[model samples]
Target: MNTIPVRVVAAEVIAEGIRLLKLSSQDGSPLPTWEPGSHIDVHLDPGVIRQYSLCGSCTDTSTYEIAVKREPESRGGSKFVHESLGVGSQLSISAPRNHFTTSTEADHNLLVAGGIGITPIISMARQFHRQDRAFELLYFTRSETHTAFRDELASGPLNSSCRLLFGLERDAVEATLDDALRNRHDGSHLYLCGPQPFMDTVRAVAARHGWPDDAVHLEYFAAAAPLDAEPQTSFDVRLARSEKTFTIPADKTIVDVLREHGTDVETSCEQGVCGTCIVKVLEGCPDHRDYFLTAQEHAKGDCMAMCVSRSLTKLLVVDL
Candidate 1:
């Protein structure tokens, strides 16, 4: 991945287990401007790359701020940020990319965030405020001590349009969602970012309220759930440009086999959380395992995540 060098200008604990890092261009020049809901791949070590949503305003191109929650089951990324990295640490980060975004043309926007998922939702809320667009934000967390950006969200400007709820059980959350989504403004779009289960509940409530799939949006920071329990089987892959065919064994992934055979495919989170390895599928059905693609896209069967997803057909003719 192409990356730009940046130095951490500030580092501080934002929430109970979350740390905020402010990174500025190493050359003291303006950085790339990014939209809300955008994220960048930060290379922490030689082979440690993780994607984090840019949380602060896009209007300020001088620096990018992101919040990293120390995952108890972290593979490496969060651990490094919490233990090894600090102010003055230099790192390489990819240019911002936004797969999750909303149209400002909407008459109203309803934003829902869960725990660390607030990172992206807050950004969108800020952008909406700047655009003077009608919007409301619902932040759900365990308690006040575990929430990030509490002061900001509780103050003027955002506080008027945002509501923070803590210690709500699933039933209560559902009831609240029912109230919030029951009578939404016309042309209102719903944005969701959070734990999969929480988003699932919100989605269920929204669906019950008659929200269409097109009017609902979601951004996932982790894999939705464990991979399917179905038995694994080998499949065939054909490159459209080279007309080359290869068999992907049950034990191996398409990218693994392709790279072993000298086919270049870029990937970041090979676990299927990130969409870095998504590729076009010209033929065959893909057993989509990634949270990066929507269910509608999965039904379309036009692309597949080569890193972790597998094919459902004997042969998959794909764009290299």
Candidate 2:
């Protein structure tokens, strides 16, 4: 990924535990254009890169906006951003990448967001509004105090099309989601981003209502649960170009082994949520442990996230 130097133009607390950051080129030039649902990787510190969804208006090329929530048990990224990053701070960021792009073909868009997941959904709502497309936004949060972009969602043009549900129990949230999906019109597409449990419940409700996989789009910031619990089997991996083979132990990752053999692979979010470490699979079956790939992609077995994924077959050959 290419990196660009940017300066923090503004920083403000939008809600409890959430901070909004606006970034721009160091030279005051226009930044790269990005579509809704796009995200950029923030290089917080050496070996600490984290992806943040762009929440600013796509029309505004002068700046990029992202909201960061301080995790209770942060592994450094969020904590640093919240406590250390301030206005005038210089930072490096990757070019914008879109894995959760909006579908322009859909006649209507139903956007659902939970907690900080509102970041991407807000951009989609703005894009849809600008294009005069039919859409509705449903935002769920713990309370009004915890909701980001409250002023914008309440007074902006999208206010009429938005619904705020706060302090709901799990069953209540599920019921609300069921009703939303149950009443969805034909040609309407669903987009969601949120905590794993919330997303799982929403997706489950959509599935129960017969929503096709293509009609539902989602982005995950973290894994639903621990991914290393299963008993791992030792495997062999061959580099197609290098013609080098390595024995991968059950406890080690493919990236670690490759690094040990003097091979370098660009990686971010080693937990497998980011797609930075994906590599092509020339010949063997991959276990498909990453949350970044779709089910169809996993079934194809053509690429794998080397950071946390492994081979399913005894010997896997990859296009190094």
Candidate 3:
């Protein structure tokens, strides 16, 4: 991954629980041009890395915008981004990457967002609005007060094509989904981002409505709980580039095993929400356990993020 050094130019609380951060390149030139739906991995406080979607408009070239929601259960990064980092603070960030890009091949677009998962989808909606494309947004949140970009999504040109669903007011999102599915035409594409159960329900309902697998795109913020709770067997991992092999116990993650062997791997959000520990998979099949990589890439086995993923075979080879 390409890495760049940036300095925080500004940090301000934008709402009750949301904070916006502005970061500029260290060299003072234009920052890397990122497409809609792109996100950068931020190395925040010590031993912490977090991923935040770029919220600034693509027309802007000098700085990137990201908003953070402080979770009550946050280990550190969110609090750091909210309280520690300020103007003139230096940090490292990964180049922008995207797996939720828009597809022009679709006849129409249907976007579903829940809570903070709205970040990338909002960027997609903005791009579609700028290009005068036809699309509708279904944003569901606990309440309008906690929803980000509420005014823009309600009254702007994008609002003309959007449907807002508030959990507090309506008590159920199923009616909205039913209407959207009924109005959805053939060749329409659906993009979804939210918690695991919400995505799962949407997927099951979409399948029931005959939505093609190829027509659905999703981004997740959390990994689904393990399907099986059986203890895993111990395995060996070989680093092909370093010609070194290490034992990985069933109870420890690959990240823990690699770190124990003195490998230089950086990780944050050990839950697999951050992509900092991503590495190339030289050989062996990977049992993907993260939410970072796309479904297509997961199938190819060309790469795996060591932070949360494990090997399927008895011995695995990876590029450190």
Candidate 4:
């Protein structure tokens, strides 16, 4: 499927370790109203598509802002966004989509961010500030200089009620988190965005402290690692649209198997993070692997991510 194109009209290096990119529509029309936590996948270079959370004000429809952090082990996407692309550059971006959102019903909001994961959390904070809601921000970073948006966050009006946590000087940040989770008031919702290890540590600590499962929400920036268990045995797949059957080996992904059978399906983020490889299912139980789908979408039993998803039965029927 073809995607819409967005142009970079202007970009500014915002704070330390962050670049605020300003994107606009190519035809001079108002961009879509993206709610808080909305993200767009930027199709850069030949085969690199990276998803970045919209860090600009959601109320602004004329343009969007995204903050990019130069990753140490970047595979050219982040470096390209930072060094190569600039003002007046044309880029392909998918429609604004959201997976992480604020729980409106919660009485208090607790936001936790690790390093660059503050992109979406910062948007949520802006929304909260606009709405005059009560919330707390616990931004964790290794050092003050490496943190993004340090000046804006420390001096901004939103910082009046927000708390900044640094792992450099003391253990006060972890103690604060422990105190908040331990002495929770009524209807407190916790939102977490970070790397895999950080998320795991926070989740484990929260669980150990008796935090409710339903109250903990997570936003991941990376593709989920494949399960460590042994691969399944050989299986067969039936494409409902083409009405063709093919066998899938345990060692091969459904995407490779389908393409080998001449199915020209489009895909990116082959690790099952992006929603690019999703397909509908006609029969048989599907083992979904994409991070895009919500818990509700899985219950419908109609869609599957072909990149890492698999069939439970020996013969599975799928809609291409």
* RMSD (Å) per prediction: 1.5, 1.9, 3.5, 3.5
lDDT at 253 for candidate 3? 83
Q: Residues 1-320, candidate 4, lDDT per residue (tens digit)?
A: 56778899888876565687999989988888898888888888878888889988899888888999887788898899888989999998877877677888888888888888889998998898889888888888877776777776899887786767776333555566677677776688888887777776677778778767667777778764664144567778888877888898888888798887778887756666556678878888876666656566777768888887777778778876
Superior candidate under TM-score, 1 versus 2: 1
Q: What's the TM for model 2?
A: 0.93
Clashes, model 3: 0
Ranking by lDDT: 2, 1, 3, 4
How do all models score by TM-score?
Answer: 0.95, 0.93, 0.82, 0.83
Local lDDT at 88 for model 3: 94
Q: On lDDT, who's better, 1 or 4?
A: 1
Question: What 10-residue stretch in candidate 3 is worst by lDDT?
Answer: 222-231
Identify the leading candidate in terms of TM-score: 1
Whole-model Cα lDDT per candidate? Answer: 0.91, 0.91, 0.79, 0.79
lDDT of 3 by residue, 98-214 (tens): 766778888788999877778888888998888888888998887777788888888887889887777633326765676677655787999988778778777777877888777
How many steric overlaps are in each model, in order? 0, 0, 0, 0
What pairs collide in candidate 1? none
Candidate 4, residue 173: Cα displacement in angstroms equals 5.3
